[model samples]
Target: MHKFGVWAPKAQKMSLCWREQVLAMNGPNHRGWWTLEVQEATCGDRYAFLLDDDSTPYPDPRSLRQPEGVHGLSEIYSHGGFEWHDQLWRGSPKTGAIIYELHIGTFSTEGTFDGAIPHLKYLADLGITHVEVMPVAAWAGKQGWGYDSVSLFATHEHYGGPDGFKRFVDACHATGLSVILDVVYNHFGPVGNYTGKFGPYLNENRKTPWGDAVNLDQEGSDEVRRFFVDNAIMWLKDYHCDGLRFDAVHAFLDLSAVHFMEQLSTEVERLGATVGKEFYLIAESDLNDPRVVRPREANGYGMDAQWSDDFHHALIAVLYSPKEGESGYYSDFGTIADLHKSLKHAYVYDGQYSGHRKRRHGRPTDGLSAHHFIHFDQNHDQVGNRGWGERFEHLVGTDAAKLSIGIVLLAPYTPMLFMGEEWASSTPFLYFADHEDEEMRRLVAEGRKNEFAAFGFGGDVPNPEHEKTFLDSKLKWDEQEEGNHGDFLAWTKALIKLRRSHVCFNDGDTHHLHVFSDERARTLVMEREEARVVVNFGDQPFAFALLEGEQLELASRAEVSVREGYLDVPPMTLAVLLSTSEQFENRQVEARARA
Candidate 1:
């Protein structure tokens, strides 16, 4: 015997259509839940709900398995059936973390969870402590980046389904890497969505840029909110995931006193305690609200961390200078001072008036620790959403790209690297989706083309539906050992090791860091503890010493030396130095002897 339940508030009647056995559902509970226990149904059985006796049936909103795709009947999956080897896997809190983000479909040749497992050791060897995967939730398309998720609970069938995910996670844990699953609860995918038919899953009154906003604050919103909160708990507890990265949390609209994010965080914490695991939640937010990561006791949402897109923007503007014309949002960035501000204060526009936004943006995060911010130079959205999906390596060239990696890894905040970024893969991470319907495909393709019109960079955007787009995005994994790619990979590995080796990389005391930059000289000086990282963003060779005479430690391009009280940094180059007078004197003496 098995139990099946669904929330169908609008349905006058609900029936469970088992394999050739249709059983009428019982009364709707006070919460609008209809449940049925079937003696004949067991694991592996396929079933769906007949809403209001309509001929068309809808899959379970919280389906564990969707073997027949998003529109087909849901399968009865036994969650704990797989044999697990990671019994002693007590996940990490991931402090001062090194995070690597990968899209399962394009990470390797196989494009499945199982395919990704073989490379876990490779990532672990790279000194990455955590792997933040893009959303795995099943969608209508055969392949995608996994942002548009319809079935939030089920792993995409194309990625080897639920069991395969467990195996992949187990493998990762075995390889000393924690797993952070990216989840989308802000909105469901556009096509093959039947949750709207089940109940008021969407708020028609509130609209987001994507579509109808999720109903988190309206009438009968409790159940709808529970559906997503419970989904978070499912991933953390049942799947043994270490953490979750919430996608586009700003898109969630809630006028209610208690926000849905707070409710979800409360439930997830409770589950994490019960399961005895170190679970965390990170958010991709544009709201710039410190309350998102502040403690719940302090009247905040209590997310563990949030992505710092502003950091990426500021760094890109500095690294890829000589801009043609400012794009939509990039117009707001591109200043050496902006990068310096981001390094010292976590955000450049911390409640300051913006010329681009035409209003004050972002709240001060001075109270929070540096670990609350996840800093990265490259991510999926920054690259794939572009017209041609060119990586930073292509945009700024190799040397600048290498310098950017060093800055991100050594920064006080947690650092993340996009897949293949370390290796400098030749392929691009283009926007692609496999939609079966031509009309829907055309609509999506057209929407993507116009998305960047405001940004002058959106020239001749490719058809996202074209087969070549997805094929071109796949990473050339073998390039890890090839030519310049190998050199870049080695450089990244060294940066990660250096970060782990130094106490200066500790993200706890962000208040102590200092950033000084020369806009005209196009040079930056980052000071933390006894170490200083100097960067020259301009095309001309730059030479200067902030503290009269400093000792060169590690140079990105070559062995650095202080000539005439200035460390000569070549064009698009960088160098690490010792700020202590004693260490500087010792290194100076050694350099003179060698010369």
Candidate 2:
């Protein structure tokens, strides 16, 4: 016999339909819970729930596997059936972690969770500690970025379904890597969403770009909050995921005094404590507020980290000029100073900005640690939203590209690499989705074209409706073995190794930045606790007056040299230096004399 339960607080009456039998359930405790037991209800059995007098069967909001897709009936799944081999695996701490963000569909040609297994070793070899997957929840169609998820609980069937994901997670853990899943709780997809048929899962009072906001603070919202919180716990507890990266917390329209984010963070922390494991929550926010990752004890939301869009925007704008004819958001950023500010401090527009939103925006992140921000040169949105979806390789030359990598990896923040970025994969991560609705498909295609016009791209944007767009985004695995691609991969690996070996590199403390020149011979020197990093962004050789006893420990071949009390750094190169042995010995002798 199997006991099934679901949260349906809005339903006056709920009945489980399985194998031609309907089992009635009772719940009025404001929990919106319904439960039923049947002998024939087993794994793989298709089921749905009948709510009130609704004739149509609604898929369970917490469906484990929708093998027939999001629009079809939910299939029962036993979480314990699979043998997990990660019994002794404890996740890596967030400090000094190298995160690689990937979309399973485009990570490999097979476009399945199983297909990505072979590349696990590649990521491991690249020194990635955590694999941050884009949203994998079941969405409307077969192909998408997984952001438009209709079934928050179910894994996408095309990506090898539930079992496939379990295997993937297990494989990752076996290789000493942790998995961080990106989850969306703000809004359902534009298609195949049936949560409303069963209850008030959306708030009409609040609206977002997607639609009505999730009912996190309205009447009957208690259960809704519980539903999402439970889902997050399920991923960590049941699926064995190490962390969750919440998508767009800025879109959460809750007005509750406690706030939905605070509630979720508190619960996740409790669950992590109970399990005796380290579970983290990362948020994707555009607010640029440090409070989101601040500790709850200080009356903050208590998220572990958030995406640093300011860092990316500042880096991209100065490095890659706005496309030929026009400029929109990228126009606001242009100087080496902007890049320097973002690298030293997480935000470029802290309490001062007008050109973008026409209003002063963003709060200062002055006291925050660098680990509170996740920095990336290119992510899914930046690449996909482009007119032709060009990667960094297409936008800049190899030298500039290496400089971008150096800035990101050596910065005092956690760094994330988009899939195929290590080797500078040529394929563009275009905006592609499998929308069965003609109107939605047309709107997406048209919107994409219009959006690129501001950037000055002349041609028509690639149609997201075409399967070829999705196919074109897949990584070319063979590139890893050839040409500049191989060189890039090697350089990235060396950088990661260097970062891991250096204690100062892992320190997220912001260093005081000193910039020598702005235009032709610019040089930035950052002094951390015991070491210093000097970077020359210009082509001509530059000199910096270092501390008397400082010596070069690591320097890029092209742009760095040390002699006497001056360090000569070449154009667009970075160098790491530490105090000389004689200096340390002299300091020790002085301390002994003082004692």
Return the top candidate by lDDT.
Answer: 1
Question: Mind giving the per-residue lDDT tens digits that candidate 1 earns over 405-434?
Answer: 989988899999999999888999999888
Quickly count the clashes in candidate 2: 3
What do the candidate models score in CA lDDT, each in turn? Answer: 0.86, 0.84
lDDT of 2 by residue, 256-321 (tens): 999888998999889878988988789999888888999999888999999999889888876777
Candidate 2 has an lDDT of 0.84
Candidate 1 matches the true fold with a TM-score of 0.95
Relative to the unseen true structure, what is the C-alpha lDDT of residue 149 in candidate 1, on a scale of 0 to 100? 85
What's model 1's overall lDDT? 0.86
Q: What's the lDDT for residue 235 in model 1?
A: 82
